[model samples]
Target: MQVLMRPWGAMHYRIDGPEDGLPVVFANSLGTDLRLWDAVLPLLPGIRAIRYDKRGHGLSDSGGPVSIADLAEDAAALIEATGGPAVFVGLSIGGMIGQALAARRPELLRALVLSNTAPRMGAPEIWAARIAAVRAGGVASIADAVMERWFAPPFRTTPALHPWRNMLARCDAQGYIAACEAIAAADLTEAAASLRLPALVIAGDQDGSSPPDLVRGTADLIPGADFHVIPGAGHLPCVETPAAWAALLAPFLQDHAR
Candidate 1:
């Protein structure tokens, strides 16, 4: 556990693998901390990986207006601070950050992985409704609803349920709403189409938030991106089916590693 203090707020992060290995920076989904990557990390061999909590998630502070660019800058700063440029692995909104960052700062990347995310999320009205809900009822108001969309019926009752449920309930309302706003405002299709880096896109079969076709569409936006869909997994394949997700990711990393 470490903290990277930014002028706006501090971010919690962890770095693993060998110093000399290829560096891969991971950004997690909304309502999750860096722990989002726990199951997937050990499966990848010989790669230096970095994972961080976005502001208001996990141990990071909740301050500043949330924008996709702001989130990208947060990741860029963390990567530059920890170990320079690396492949960026991001999930959900993290994938959105990867797209925005890759467009804004292409030089700071080796390869890119976007998991269970899309070019754009819901409409502005949907985000507005979410912001209103959080403001009226706090993060707890949407915890179960968010979880419902995150995992399927079977996995929802597993031991894994509690931590994520709590993680959502405990998130700072302001920060969570801010993230919702960023998702509402961001559209990365054009930017993703412009990327020249090696890219991989992973989708979970049962993901309602970003369905397999949506994820595939995102992959199609990139010239040579590889796409994989995890069977029996919901939104967070890293949690529901890490091995399968790793099977898809590790090879891509190997193919693109410098």
Candidate 2:
């Protein structure tokens, strides 16, 4: 329930692990809040972790329409709040923000991890169609289809599906639409390819949204970045395979520890 009251608006955030430990910040996917990292957090209790909802998602207040640059600035503000030169881990749109942030404020990040995301999600037409759908029918219009794309077959049948559905259903339509617009406007190929910091790019083999090759292409953009794929997991690997996700992350964090 903690919040960081920025001049633009308040951002909901939570901190775990010790303040003196290696700082690890997490930015979640679109349609999800900080809780997206719940399962993964317990496994990484050794490193200091910070999680936040972007302006629109989770418990944070919305700022009407926004762009990818706006989202990246918000992330920069939060990392600056932490005095972070720490590792930044982001998923989906969160990953897009990380790419934008690294390019915008490279000094704030010691390393980066982009999971189940892309430099650009879909084409302008695709995003426009999605935005039109949400505005017309609300978040419920796309929740089921999004769920299908976000999780693997086994996860779709699990009880976890209930809460995720509820989370999506509860999100503000304007906020969801705003984030979708941001995703649409984002084009980070140049920014991602220019990064000089330690970076790890991860993907779920079964992810329908940002498939492994797409994620790999993003990794390829960063000169020396590492890439890994989690089998049997979809876009949200931290959910379907938390332990495996953590296993892949632990060494990368250590290698890039500040």
- Error at 39, model 2, angstroms: 0.2
Question: Root-mean-square deviation of each candidate, in angstroms?
Answer: 1.2, 1.0
Q: Model 2 over residues 78-153: C-alpha lDDT tens digits?
A: 8788768879999999999999999989998999999998898988898899889988999888999899989998
Question: Residue pairs in steric clash, candidate 2?
Answer: none
Task: Report lDDT per candidate.
Answer: 0.89, 0.89
Model 2's number of clashes is 0
RMSD of 1: 1.2
For model 2, what is the C-alpha lDDT against the true structure? 0.89
lDDT of 1: 0.89
Clash pairs for candidate 1: none
Q: Model 1, range 201-248, lDDT digits (tens) per residue?
A: 999888978889999999999998888888898999999898999999
Residue 246 displacement (Å), model 2: 0.5
